[model samples]
Target: MKVLVVEDSDRLRRSLGDGLTKSGFSVDLAADGHEALAFIRTYDYDVVVLDLMLPGQSGLEVLRQARDEGRDLHVLVLSARDQVADRIRGLEMGADDYLIKPFDFGELVARLRALVRRRYACKNPRLRVGRVEVDTAARCALRDGEPVHLTPGEYAVLELLVRRSGTVLSQDQILDSLHGGEYAVSSNVVQVLISSLR
Candidate 1:
């Protein structure tokens, strides 16, 4: 999975980036809302971890613009404000989930996983398609009740397919979902991953 962590606090941003990287996500960091908007415009992220208080532009503004432009990326708002009204407003502004600051890292990861599953219209964390089962939280796949080892690229492609199971995803969309602007990917890489999965 790829995620964007948008926070004004340098320390918290770095901590979340490192922890999320270790937890198996490609992460991008933005100090404030403007930087985040730039990333959002240029790349495709599975989710955005946005902080409400920001310089240049506020997080809510970022969320609003992204939604207005029809960007369907999942957004999880992180704010120090824990008030009920604030939470409601964030959700109303198109945030998939809201997390207060000083939250447990584990909880954040868990919530992100849930959002990813939701994006795929997967109500169950353990997704089963035919005899293939994928544990989204564990980042592992099982085939015929036996574990199937998958390279990161292959797993990423599979995840994307599972997320949009009933639809046909062109190669460009698969590439977008796999890597952001920071990393260069060959056009045929998506095909390679799909062939490998087959």
Candidate 2:
């Protein structure tokens, strides 16, 4: 999965980027809301970890702009302020989840996984389609109760399709979802991957 961390504090930002990378997610970092907006415009991220207090623009403002622009990005707000009103305001502004500062890294990972899963309605973290089952949290796949090895690219494609089952995603959308703006992808790559999946 790919994630964007928008935080003003350099220490926290680096920590988040490093920790998420260690957790097997491709992570991008932005020091302020303006940079965050730029990243959002150019990339597709599974989830955004946004800090409410920011320079250039406030995190709430960024969230509002994203919603107004019809960007359906899942957001998880991180704020030092843990007041009930603040949490409610963040949710009202379109944040999917909120985490207070001084939090456990494990808890953050669990919450992020839950948020992403809920966004895709992946009822079982172990995703099952036909004879294949994918354990997303474990990053493993099985076919007919036996292990089915897959390259990272192939797994990414399968995960994207399974996350949005029944939706006919065009090739461009598939490519964007897989790379998250970190790499340029060929438009025909999706077709090649789909053929391999079949």
- What's the TM-score of each model vs. the native? 0.69, 0.70
Choose the strongest candidate by TM-score. Answer: 2
Off by over 4 Å in 2: 122-148, 157-198
lDDT of 1 at 46: 81
Instruction: Give the lDDT of residue 195 in candidate 2.
Output: 87
The digit string of per-residue lDDT tens for model 1 on 9-71 reads 999999999899788777889998889999999877889999999998999999999999999
Q: What is the model-wide C-alpha lDDT for candidate 2?
A: 0.85
Off by over 4 Å in 1: 122-150, 157-198
